[model samples]
Target: MIDARRGVLYPDRMPRFHRLPPMPEAQHLVAWFWIPEWDLGPGETSRQDVVAYPALNLVVEPSGVQLVGATTAATHRDLTGRGWAVGALLRPAAVPALAEKPSELRDSWAGLSAPDLLEPVAAAMDGDDDDRLLRAVAIMSRWLAERAGEPTDAGLQANAMSELLMTDAGIRTSEQAATRLAVSLRTLQRMTHRYVGLPPLAMIRRRRLQEAAQRLRDDPGIDLAALAAELGYADHAHLTGDFRTVLGMAPSGYRQEL
Candidate 1:
């Protein structure tokens, strides 16, 4: 239930965060659903940092629903009051239904006009009972199934491309991704641009960066060069450069903070 520390930067200080698997009906559209609830006293604030996954998200709050695009860098949010949000980490098959030009929406979010979804989700979160979250997810699942419909042939191929890029450590290059997916380099690039809003190599680099950060967080005394080599980087400097570029700090600096 509690997803805890995959993309999270600070596992120890995270508020109440839960990750739920998508219902069977919506599996083609959603990777998973995430809920985070936080309650803080006056004058207190909690800042949550994340190396976000390279995918779009459909988020619902008390106010409304928003379609968030794939992020190119690390992100942080400051929580200052009592609140919560439910979000679906959307798969590539679902992107075209929500955003026609995925590249145009990169690093930004647009408001979605779906009052039918907002009402029941708000009602579910109003209660403190345990099953309320599940009830809310079920409602969202039905909505997504109706809105996105079924995947097309190209959409299914795009989904496979995304899965391979995110999960395969051997896939260090976009050419390799294209080869594994049985598509030309041009086709792979086109598919990712249309469905993922990012280059295939960017997705691979994101996965490697997330793994590097996790390894550093879990093993403070581990060798940096070894970590970089394991993650398919050229050397320690390449790893440090990636950290500084995306995380705004060097790997050693980040470890010191932890």
Candidate 2:
């Protein structure tokens, strides 16, 4: 399955990252809950970067909590000391329930606004940073597990569009995606930009780069040429360029880090 936890464009950083299954009832709206921690020895520093996924994230750190919107570019967070975070990765099509429209949160991380989800989570958080995260996740699971029911309407439509862009490698252009979604290019653009925080074609490109990063991280020895073709790149050179665009390095450079 595609990794629901996006980012980490530089696998060589050697930070600890893990994904745990979300509550069963919340699975449709949440991909997984994740906890990542890093403790660089004294005088050491590490930078973790990711190209980001087209999903909202509710992140809780020792300092505070944030409702992060979909990001449009690769980003990095530099860490110098011990730090950790608990994050809930939203499903592609699900509105954060916190935002009136997902687009309203684009390129931003806001303080908790979804009372139904945040109130319980914050009240339950306490103790050590990791403990606070664990407690928060437990509360989150319960909250989502008991919600009215599955997502509907626009949520379904947004998710369907996202799955098409991520899983169907043949789609590489806006016209192709608009046809596949059976909507006019203009309509597709509007819906995706509003719902996914990215234009339809940009979402497709993001997924491709996201997947390429994971594949390289998992299997450093994989053939770049073959991988390029599998990911719908026109050639190895094209793949290299795409990787550079999203990750700041070519596939070989990333693999070398591994």
Candidate 3:
């Protein structure tokens, strides 16, 4: 299972962010929907840190619609004012359908405009919150349904390979990922690098670090040394180093924030 709990970085602010499962037919194309609404006091600015998965997103915000691509590393978005957003998180296999070279979109986003599915979604944006979200996602679903063709055999297998690496903690390291995918290590690396926007090890590390951050939020009192070892970190210092490097905060400090 893709652990939803481990996807977002700031669990303490859960009320401001949430995700909904995509319709079954859209699962192969869209992983889920992320909804974030925030009201900030004057002089208040909040930064949202995210350890994104090997996927893309269609984000609709107060500004406009944007097709957010896969990110090669961790990133943060600074939030201000009172605003809300609805986003469709695309799956790894869905990248090629949207962009020929997935890496071209890595860490970058493209703007969207009128005359697409955004019309209805944009029109419904001013209404009640629930209705707005429903109308928006429904239109998006219809749009994706038209292009939800099954990916190539290798793409499908690559998605399956990513799934195992992300969801199963037992499968650590690229070698383990190759074993799970029943492919040679070199083959898995090549496919993931070409289609997934990152090497298998990098993607695996991203998911692992996200999971670690979540655990820190959920149980701040847990032993960092044990947690580090459990998560395959070389040592306690290793865990802190990764936390600081990726999230810009030490693990202990992250837990304290929670």
Candidate 4:
């Protein structure tokens, strides 16, 4: 079984990410609940660079369901007091089939503005029973499967490429990617935009900035000029300018916050 906990980052004081082992029949879906330490307020809006997945996330504690998107990273803050969250991950193609539009799903099932689904979801969270949450996930899966059908191999490939564009540091150019895929540059660009939203170059810059942010957070001592060169920026000034544009803060300011 794939490790459901791998993608999650839990602070030291909280319970480790928890999940029921994947049953053979339901390997396509993974469900889990997390109760984070109540000490930190939500962190700054970290730019999550992810490819769009055709999945729905139900926030049980506050009660809501949202269609996940690829446009930007979801913002998160540390919550104080004990709180609970349950999330369900589904195949990517299932998303469009399940909702009228992607934005509609986000509107219906996220944050303080959730649909009536919130009440039951919150109730399930408050109770110790797993049946209710499991049932909800099963119902959603069945509904999506009926409408969306199973994911296609092409769709999976597209999704994989999209993820690599956003997260993989080594993937730097369309020419390099085309060489790997044995396709023309034009073909790669078109396919990437269709699946990943942003073009290859834009995605590369975004990923670099994200890495820079993480580095700043983890080590305040990284010199700005060296950091710029490390990320492939032409010069320190170029890095400074781009960092301000993407993060709304200077590199020094960001480092100080660490």
TM per prediction: 0.97, 0.79, 0.89, 0.60
Q: For residues 147-252, what per-residue lDDT tens digits would candidate 2 score against the true structure? A: 5256777777767777787777788898998898898999888878766677887788888888788888778889999999888888999889987876778889
- Encode model 3's per-residue lDDT on 115-143: one tens digit a residue: 57666666776686566676767777667
lDDT (Cα) of model 2: 0.74
Task: Give the lowest summed-lDDT range of ten residues in model 2.
Answer: 122-131
In candidate 1, which residue pairs clash?
A: none
Model 4 ranges off by over 4 Å: 1-61, 72-84, 87-124, 128-148
lDDT of each: 0.89, 0.74, 0.76, 0.51
Point out where model 1 deviates above 4 Å. 1-5
**Which residue pairs collide in model 2, if any?**
none
Model 4 Cα shift for residue 173 (angstroms)? 2.4
State which candidate has the highest TM-score.
1
By lDDT rank, best first, the candidates go 1, 3, 2, 4
Residue-level lDDT of model 4, residues 1-258, one tens digit each, is 222332221223243334543333333433333232122335522222222222344334453555443333323344454555555554333344444444444313434344455555566556667475555444444444454556676556555554555555666676776676666888767665554344567656666666677666567798889989888788988787866775556788757644
In model 3, pairs of residues that clash are none
Global Cα lDDT for candidate 4: 0.51
